[model samples]
Target: MNPVTAYRFITANQFAVVGASTDRSKYGNRVLRWYQAHELPVIPVNHKEATVESVPAIASIEEIDDPANAAISIITPPKVTLGVLKKAKELGIQKIWLQPGAEDKAVLDYAREAGLDIIAGGPCILVQGPSLLTHRANL
Candidate 1:
């Protein structure tokens, strides 16, 4: 899909950062920050109870109360992405932003097979996010 379409999908949803970490140095953390800065409702998904950037860090996708119109921003290891995708499917999430390095061809195929609408490997969230903001401002 085009960047505009992808941005619309993200901004219109209750977004979740699935691979969000407690570590400040990771891209997941940066994504969480970007979402927060944009005033997006972003749930940080991590195994740790510790909060990241002041957002409550959830341990799993199943824990989210409102999965309706939820989009998951995935930035986890490739090995773990399938499990996340599976959980997303189970929870009825449709949109997913699979960060670069978070998935391989197999994972991509799997996501497609699972019928998830995904945005992957084109631009990082930091770039797409700002571009989206600009697009909205111009409108």
Candidate 2:
């Protein structure tokens, strides 16, 4: 994961939490809560739910009002990650954060081939967020 890229991503005007869940026990829900706790503007994407944490959730990336420059944090399985990437590519969304356990070798390869700027593997957002938030404040 590239620290610079991650910073750029988190600092975007808007962010999307793909695969966000209502189940607080799940990482998907946890990720969504982190953004909310920080008072960030985030869209929750969940095909199965109309709302997550009381926020309206879009079922897919295609529903985003502004996808060309949007940043997204994915918390889905590898297969779903790939599909999200494909849609994101078509929408011109370039900044993607593949949360831990959300990616596999194939997902990584496809992101690369599609020219996505992704932060995958270790250092989940919860780890870097506090510092990153402070960094943003300082900036």
Candidate 3:
């Protein structure tokens, strides 16, 4: 993993928390809450909902008007995550963080093959979020 890429990913201001939910106990909800708590510009991507944690949830990455400038943190099932990865690549989203349980060999391979900056393999956003907030603040 490129240190620069990870740094860029962790420090990006605009983001989309794909698979976000309203249920506070879910990791999806926690991730969204972390972004909101930090006062960042974050879009909640959830096809089944109108909104998530007060932010209007978008159905897909293609729906985002400026996806290229934003990084994404995904917390969905493996199959859904694969589709999101494909769309993220298609939309030129440079960075992605896959929350624990969202990864698989195929997804990791695609991210590498697509040349995306990714955070995976068990370092969850909910754990790293405070550090990311500090990194963002210093930027």
**Candidate number of the best lDDT:** 2
Off by over 4 Å in 3: none
Error of 2 at 80 (Å): 0.7
**Model 2, range 1-139, lDDT digits (tens) per residue?**
6878878887777889998999999999999999999998889999999999999999998998888667899999999899999988889887788889999999989988888888898788888777778656755
Candidate 1 error regions (>4 Å): 1-8, 134-139
Whole-model Cα lDDT of every candidate shown, in order: 0.80, 0.88, 0.84
Q: Over the stretch 1-139, how does candidate 3's per-residue lDDT look in tens digits? A: 3557667887775889898988999999999998888788899988899999888999887887777778899999988899999988888888888889898999899888988778888578777666656667678
**Which candidate should be chosen as best, given TM-score against the real structure?**
2
> Cα RMSD for candidate 1?
2.2
lDDT of 3 at 15: 87
- Model 1 worst lDDT window (10 residues): 130-139
Residue pairs in clash, model 3:
none
Q: Candidate 1, clashing residue pairs?
A: none
